[model samples]
Target: MSARPEAADQSRGSAFRGEGLRKIYRTGETEVEALRGVDLDVAQGEMLVLLGPSGSGKSTLLNIVGGLDRPTEGRLFYRETELTGMKEDEMTRFRRQNVGFIFQFYNLIPSLTAEENVQLVTDIAADPMDAREALEMVGLGDRAHHYPAQLSGGEQQRVAVARAVAKRPGVLLCDEPTGALDSQTGIRVLETLVRANRELGTTVIIITHNVGIGAVADRVFHFLDGQIARIEKNDHPIQPVEITW
Candidate 1:
């Protein structure tokens, strides 16, 4: 049966949709199931928090959604494009044009300045802001010339943020982005992410074990034992800085 018009419209408003998503791994005789028939949708311009314990398949699902990993079964769609069965080159192109990834550890080159690092991506992007402008968006304008080793962990991460957003991707996937920093520093990184979503209209998905971080997200998904146990929507998400660690 066809869904109600309003329901269909609501689904269309989402940037990503996953239906019956599953992933399994086999090593020798041992088999491991990372995800089992999980379904999810993330709205456009929404900041979603993925909260889960270790080995809950949160990372696996995030990777698949970002096209970093291929799924064992099921499907993932970005707007109208089916991402599940695309070729490797196609996926690479899709990722370059549509997705931005932020990892827990800021993988910055120690020899390169922040602007230089950001410039690398801007050069490849179809339409990109100046490296200085990208740094300014993350509240790191003055640190543009600083090398990764000379900056604090938070500052380094912010540089990573600038690099990711410089490309102006449709979706931002952050995997434990603030894991390496102290509480205060972590807030700064989170604030940058929030700002990126609000100013640039990027759909941001943050995967973290910190439940406290959910207050800033428009929606939160709690993953338990490789499945989504609960989904919560916040009408008014608090600012990242206002929520204590």
Candidate 2:
């Protein structure tokens, strides 16, 4: 939430770059390779989608990129910061200020109203937009006083999106953000994400198995057997509302 002034040297290149990244989970003699030496680059202000089946390491890759998990081997650079080697405390600070996360579930407090749920983040965020403003951005201004239980699942998820973007984070990481919603609701949620990317210039990364969702991404990364099998770039992306996914 604390805004760090953009470094003079920061360019519109890779917002995140992982070189030979690997994650090994060892339990006694058996070792599980969650990531098999992944090398990928995500440009700033781009909406990128990562598609893969279960156990394909999509979530693992996202965790590593978001600084939520550290790679056992390799390097990760965020702009100029050495995120892969940073201490846990340093990583926590980095995540707090630069990253916004949206999970499959809305994760809103049961007792809080929509605005209150968002206000909780603003209170701790160093440079957050007002809760009302964030809610308005997501078309939830009229529901500010409504509780999560009173709103439909789609509305609740939109509120969740508002809370994540309120701090104006540098990166937005979404993991099956619409997994619990119907296709119609999912489309609306994706629209909000696309809007944020365009209007706020926030770098967005969505991890989902839904291949149809890739139509609106600037680039799509397909993973298989824990590695990137293909990378495709779309010169022009369809608007979120028009995308099939």
Candidate 3:
């Protein structure tokens, strides 16, 4: 997962800066702390991996960063813009304009073809690539006419990736992207994600429990008990094809 020589230059600017981030959820009498004082900086166009168990707060942090949720106490900056205090509509606009998301499930429309599914986003985006171009980026050009039910799991996930990136978002957030795929299929999905980051210069943050997948990231943030325990930088990252389960 070694980065290109130019990656360092691209990372000179901060894409996301978080300080003292904390999230507490209240379910009746129980109070659950999802994130506890998380402080981090994600460089522009950098590939970062968030590694942790189910309750370790990695997903919570990703959601907040992607503008899907807000922190209970903390400040988050996307480039120079502050996202911590944004209203719902502001957050929606921010996410629509700058962020892209890929989840464990494909979430594609069963009724639409792959290209049509991607078109759903491009139609609303300010600036977007052609639907076919987006599908081609994920190696699904030939499957553009295929419906979600006709595609394999890996293909479906790749379609999801294409749909997310069709808008040419600045940041790409993936949560357990390969959770439902086999190792071989997962590798393909990872390759698509890496291609997006490399070719499009999209800042990527992936949330996963797989230690092997972390090898592809420039930096890995390890989470434990709702907090980041440590951070590891990989001077030489391995490619997705080289990673093993």
Candidate 4:
């Protein structure tokens, strides 16, 4: 949807780098290869999108890069630190300190108000922003006192985004973040993600099935059968408002 700009200074250091990354799951006699020798580099402050159908390895790759899953074989680096070699506890710390995740489901605690839901994260994060401040960043300042059920679907999703960004993590990983919303509502989520990326200087990586959504990404990785089929670079990615909803 957009052409890639030429390399910039930020490109000199990658936010994430993976080489020969592979993930395999064996249940009983069956073995499933979730990722197959995947390799990628995500630049700092760039918006990267993963586009593929279900079971196409998009989530698998995202998980490995986010420290949620380890590659059965291969190396993963966050900047200069090798993630694949980190132990469970070490990986946990890495995730807590550097990664923020948003999923398709809101995952907000229904019993908690929007601000409280965000507070859950701020409490554990090493350098978290105020929960209300996070909500305000997503334009949900007034809704901070509302619970999940009291908010609309879009508002709930915005709360989720606020929660994720509250930690001020170095990278934000989203898996089908807009999958549960209509196009217009989805655009609002995209706008929030873009704001986080641009203003926070966080590397934003998203996985989505909607082709049009890729228009807002600086680069898109097209996945097929556990591997990246191709990558599209966009020098001038359009704003979320410009997408056909």
What is the per-residue lDDT of model 4 for residues 1-245, given as tens digits with 9 covering 90 to 100?
21122332364578887778889999999999988888777888989999988998998888888888889998888999988789899999999999999999999999999999999999999999999999999999999999899999999999999999999999999998999999889999999999999999999999998899899998888888888888888889999999875
Whole-model Cα lDDT per candidate?
0.88, 0.87, 0.91, 0.89
User: Candidate 2 or 4, higher lDDT?
Assistant: 4
The true-versus-predicted C-alpha distance at residue 233 of model 1, in Å, is 1.0
TM-scores of the models, in the order given: 0.95, 0.94, 0.95, 0.94
Q: How well does candidate 1 match the true structure in TM-score terms?
A: 0.95
The sequence of per-residue lDDT tens digits that candidate 1 reaches over residues 60-83 is 989999999988888889988999
Q: Which pairs in model 1 have colliding backbones?
A: none
TM-score of 3: 0.95
| Model 2 lDDT tens row, 16-68 | 87788888989999999988888877778989998888988889989988888
lDDT of 3 by residue, 54-87 (tens): 8989999999999998999989999999999999
Count clashing residue pairs in model 2: 1
> Which lDDT value does model 3 have at 34?
92
Top lDDT hit: 3
Candidate 1 global Cα RMSD: 3.1
Candidate 3 or 2, higher TM-score: 3
